[model samples]
Target: MPVVREFTLPDLGEGLTGAEIIRWLVEVGEVVAVDQPVVEVETAKASVEVPCPYGGVVTARFGAVGEEVPVGAPLVTVAVAASEGDDDAGGSGNVLVGYGTAGHSAAPRRRRVRPVQTRPAAVPAPQPTAQPAPRPARSGPLPVISPLVRRTARELGVDLATVSGSGPDGLILRADVTRAAAAVVSRETSAAAPEPAVAWDDDVVPLRGLRRTVAEKLSRSRREIPDATCWVDADATGLLALKDQLAARAAAPRIGLLPLLARICTAALARHPDLNASVVTEPDGTPTGIRRHRAVHLGFAAQTERGLMVPVVRDAQLLTTEQLAAEMARLTEAARTGSLTPAELTGGTFTLNNYGVFGVDGSTPIINHPEAAMLGVGRIAAKPWVHDGELAVRQVTQLSFTFDHRVCDGGTAGGFLRFVADCVENPGELLRYL
Candidate 1:
């Protein structure tokens, strides 16, 4: 008789409530060893592979791909043998030692090694040592490449395996595909068609997943929140000088404008707490009240392959510049690699979108859900401006703030922006607060 056991989904980390099934590694009736990979799940931050805890034949799978499963839900079932020596039927059902019960054995069987025969040395001419067998050739289909590279290859008529991969794990990448396509085009110049002078219709692209979610959130934010945005042209000459001075100092990770911006925003929030609060809707669809969070959890917008993810730096008010930089670096790396947990992506009290990296002057960023306000930072440029009635070139950056009118009035938002500008204009004055 075969023993049967069920395995539940374990919490990956950070108190994640659920995850979406990306793919299943095993199928029913297949025998799997303990700790073998069974399924891949995609959470808010990243995708992780889960392994089986029981060694047995797979009996059933609890969920399918693309299904979101809650924590502690049964994921799969397997059947096992009751005992090795006892063939009798009444010895108790097959119990998986790692999962269902504690009394069952967990040790894996070890293969026995054969002892060398002494008589073989005495044999005439001593038979030649047995040659090691050659490795078996790889069978079935060729390796898989990324979708982007595949599409590019099809359009350019390039062989994927021939291209050298520079990406992680020797996998074919977009750059490699592009270079291969370019080489092909260069070699077959005579076969190329003449460029068309007439304008052609652009292909219609479909929005799904991340892009769709972003569109919905942006629309909802515009419709639900009575947003009031204010832009301020701040003189950051002093801040740049301070940054230069700090960079010269000996430190493991050099601090930059991002951490300084975070510090300034935190201090401004402290001065004007209303800008940090947001309105909450009741379960019945009525306005419950304004929810004010005491601590500042600053969310920084990080653009990733999946979509836009904002990982929060909790308790920003209590951290120093170096600490803030380290946290920002860690969270941003996690976001890029899809390793951020659900909790780290949620529970942000305020958000900041840095469009400066893209060379944009200014943009009114949408407020993340349940957050009262969002701050946008534009490119820092050296522009000629009037200072004390004299023409001078100064470093200027645009700061835009969008706030929920229900939580904070226009006056309060203006005050917060002004305070931030003051800090950026005079970094020396911020030392008092630090």
Candidate 2:
């Protein structure tokens, strides 16, 4: 008899306890190789392709697409052929997602797996696609992860104890609870009840995945941080001239406006270090003061097809204009393709948001949580301004700075914003820091 081994979902990223199933790479009764990607999942941090450690016949798969599965929940079961001398048959030596160990190896070969109807005790059985039956009387703590899921169940008034879990070890997933809630509505409706005269046409979108994560983060920021915004109109003619000058140079790296502003930000942060720090809070949300980071892990906003993501450039204060341009370009491409790792998306002392791309003049952006401040750059356009006592059409832009009031008062914030504005007006100001 072939031995059936279960493979559970592993932690995909730092602090990510669960992930939503985006796609399935393997099907039931399919032959799989050890360390082969079995499924694709999206967490709050990033999207990841998780590989299975066991190589054998895939006997069963749990969780449907769009379903959220918690870490350590069973994902799939593989049945490997029993062989002489090997205590664990069809096992893998490599552990990709925190499961499996060395010594066992199985080649990609066909194995006669019993009927799919017979699954291991850990594998979840399929449920009715349309209205699932009410969850039977079960006894145990609800195997649930991700507070978002629990909140969804609670908001929908679905009794989790009565809902059947389609995840390994009967772990309840978001999709399962949603289905159970729908089943309750179906059971309560009367077949003879008259239908609506005209069907409602409103499209309802449930906040999930990245959108939900962003909502929660922004809400937390509003609740925790007593934030304030300061704005300054800057004369950007010098900055644009410098950009032109650099472009005119022989074999100079193509630098964008963002990198130049980023360079200025680093210099400005050096002068006002308080803006480059995060407030430390006790677990119960008690303020313990602020943590000043020596190295500037600069985060910049990158809008992608999925959503808005802030990709951090670590130790950005050490990089020059050319280097910052290169790093920003790489991270922007990764963000567009949804290939950024969790590390690339987090740990920032400050953020730079260029809303100018959208042709916006100004915006009061909510500070990226945990970070003390964010500098918003508006569109640079030709505006009439007094230059050297003469009114001339000069390239001008609005700079909006949002900072945590808890970290610094208006004086420090004004000083930082003024430093950035001066750098924009006189690119020579940055030479002092360089």
The most accurate candidate by TM-score is 2
Write model 2 residue lDDT over 320-434, tens digit each, in one string.
8999999999999998988788889889889999999999999999989999899999999999999999999999999999999999999999999999999999999888888
lDDT of 2 at 355: 98
lDDT of 2: 0.80
What's the TM-score of every candidate structure? 0.65, 0.82
Put down candidate 1 lDDT per residue, 295-399, tens digits, no spaces: 999999998887888899999988988899889999999988877765678789999888898999999777887789999989999999787799999999999
| lDDT against true structure, model 1 | 0.71
